[model samples]
Target: MYAFEYKRPASLAEAAQLLSGDDEAKLVAGGQTFIPTLKQRLAQPSTVIDLGAIGELAGIREEAGGVTIGAMTRHGQVASNDVVRRVIPSLAGMAEVIGDPQVRNLGTLGGSIANNDPAADYPGALLALQATIRTNKREIAADDFLTGMFDTALEADEIIKEVHFKKPDVGHYEKFRNPASRYAIVGAYVTRYGGTVRVAITGAGACAHRWSAAESALGGNFAADAVAGLTVDAGDLNSDIHASADYRAHLVKVMTQRAVKACA
Candidate 1:
């Protein structure tokens, strides 16, 4: 890694001030992706502001008719937290399967969503559950927060505070992941709240997005057969060596079906 000044602020306000004052500073939460990028010389910042020491940014709480997860909360914590499991077990399950033990231990929810990796798991769940992303500045809807690959709507110095997720009446997540990294090649999160059904798909496109067609169909009939004829367009999906765009589109449908089945 290139030489850089490291600062671990004890509070959110301090971190925000530090970030706003430096034009060439970067934030590090769990360092799962940032550390590797630094090692490969893909990113060389003048200062690396570590968010780990900020105690207020990590925890799980029951509130607002659902659950609120602090930004710096680790994946393993989310996976094993009793409140998360009780309020949104499918979310906990999704957290449980992200990467391997090392990645799970080191990756933070804020960092993952901020990085906005297309294959990341949280986006799908957030979109499907219609979660809210609360930052130091303001609150952003999950749909508005995730823009594209490796992108978000956060400002230059904005810091995510917590994510508030509505407890769905029924929810499930299904994914076809890369065996090595365990990153989803195509993943689907299905959720139903009263009569409204939402389906979110990840890894197949530039970013996680709601499958409106599938959602509409499933809303009418919450079952696997509901989406039997639904087709995901392949033209805009990611086609890497791991899988073709067409294959990923196919997996979207399959995973959505499987998720719906599990919810049933």
Candidate 2:
């Protein structure tokens, strides 16, 4: 990694101040992606502000008729937290399979969502569950927070505080992951809130997005057969060596069907 000054702030205010003062500074939550990029010489920030020392940024709480997860909360904590498992077990399950132990233990929810990796698991969950992302500046809807691949709506000085997720009546996630990286090639998160059904898809496009057609069909009949005739457009999807756009589109339907069935 290129030489850079590192700061581990003890409080959120301090971190925000440091970030705002230095335009070339970068924030590190778990350093899962940023650290690797630094080592590869892809990013050379003058300062690396670490959020790990901010105790208030990490925790799991049950509130607001759902669950509020602190931004710096680690994947393994989310996966194993009793409150998370009880309130949104499917979300916990998604976290459980995000990556191998090392990644799971090191990656943070805030970093994952803020980075907005198309193949990341949390984006799909946030979109499907209708989450509210609370930052140091303002509250942004999950749909508005994730813009595109490796992008978010966060400002240069903004810091995510917590994510509040609406507890769905029923929810499940399924994915066809790349074996080596364990990143989703095509993943689907299905959720039903009373009569409204939401289907969020990931790893198939530039960003995680909802599958409206499937939601409409599933809202009418929450079953696998309801989506049997449904198909996702492959033109806009990612076509990497791991899977073609068409294949990922196909997996979208298959995974959605499987997730819905799992919810049942």
Candidate 3:
């Protein structure tokens, strides 16, 4: 909203250089989140570096036992990609349900993961699938990459190149979203490989987190009924006009059940 210089660099190196040199500069991926923040005067960057012109940041590749998605890859592309559907259908399903058509077409994986929104779908999926976050500088495990609400381990000016998700033997994501915005009130992703099980819960706390209790319970039984007795604490959850923390906590259990069932 405020007057700011804009630069659409042809390569990642130029974009990084532009960002690193300016103390008050920001990177623009899809601008789904950043644009609104700027309009509200919540952020005022001296310069805006757009990564849209960089062609290398936009594709999907199938790996030996996983799928590697580029940073600028849109949700719509991921949702409809044959390789994604064949290798990790749950991730494809997650992308298909994100914020309707416009948002799907504009929102990028790197933007979503870098913003680290607690209610974002990709964070929970990354955690459950044990994905790797690849940056220009280094590759960070999903567990270590996300630190807190809207926070990541990425250094200043660091650009995420891609994200790699390992194929789970069985996986599914279930979300209870706010009707108006479609943001997850409480979302759960369940993944299983051999005897190991992993569960990630989002929108119920400060950040998307792995639900170890549910993982252990379902790892032993691999059934919806196995998690019926589990209770999520509301003590550290989000509470607002749409839903109370108590309600969100309740939904976490319900959605987790649904996700597990989908996997089964």
Candidate 4:
């Protein structure tokens, strides 16, 4: 890694101040992705502000008919948290399958959502469950927070403080994971809240996105047949050596069907 100044701020206000002053500063949460990029010389920030020291950015609590998780809360914590398991079992199940134990132990919800990796699992859950991202500066809805693949609405000086997810009446996630990295080849998160049904698809497109057509069909009939009847357009999907765009679309439908079963 290139030589850099490291700042570990105790508070979010101090962290923002430290970041705003440094023209080339990057925030490091879990450092699962950024650290590798640093070693590869893909990034050369003048300063690295570690959010780990901020005590307010770590924990899980219930509020306002939903669950709020501090940004620094690790994937392992989310997977194991009793409140998460009780309130959003499907979301907890999704967290349990991310990477291996080491990555889970280090990786965090805020980091995953901020990075917005196209293949990441948390994006699928966030989008499907109607999550809200809280930053030091402002709060962004999940739809607005994740702008694109490896992109988000976060400003350079902004630090994500926590994430709020509404407890769905029923929800489930299914993924076709890459054997080596455990990244999603095609992941689907399906949710139903009262009469509303939502389907979020990831790993098949440039970013995780909601499927309105499937949601519409499922809103009326929440069944595998509802997903089966709808045709997925391959035009907007990602295609690569591992799987073609058309194949990914097929996987999306199949996984959505599986997710429905899991939700039921």
Superposition-based RMSD of candidate 1 using all C-alpha atoms, in angstroms = 0.6
lDDT of 2: 0.94
Ranked by lDDT, the better of candidates 1 and 3 is 1
Which portions of model 1 miss their true places by more than 4 Å? none
Q: Residue 85 in candidate 3 has what lDDT?
A: 98
User: Per-residue CA lDDT of candidate 2, range 142-175, in tens?
Assistant: 9898888888999989999999999999999998
Question: What is candidate 3's lDDT per residue for 1-264, written digit by digit as tens?
Answer: 898999999998888899889989999999888899999999989999999999989999998699999999999999999999999999999999889999899999999999989899899989998899988889999999989999999999799999999999989999998899888989999999999999999888888999899999998999999999988888889999988989998898999999998987
Tens digit per residue, CA lDDT, model 1, 30-72: 9999999999999999999999999989999999879999999
How high a TM-score does candidate 2 get?
0.99
Clashes of each: 0, 0, 0, 0
Q: Distance from true position, residue 76, model 2, in Å?
A: 0.5
The reply for model 3, stretches above 4 Å from the true place, is none
lDDT of each: 0.94, 0.94, 0.92, 0.92
Per-model TM-score, in order, reads: 0.99, 0.99, 0.98, 0.98
lDDT of 4 by residue, 26-125 (tens): 9999988889999999999999999999999999998887899999999999999999999999888999999999999999998898898999999888
Candidates 2 and 3 compared: the better one by lDDT is 2
State the local distance difference test value for candidate 4. Answer: 0.92
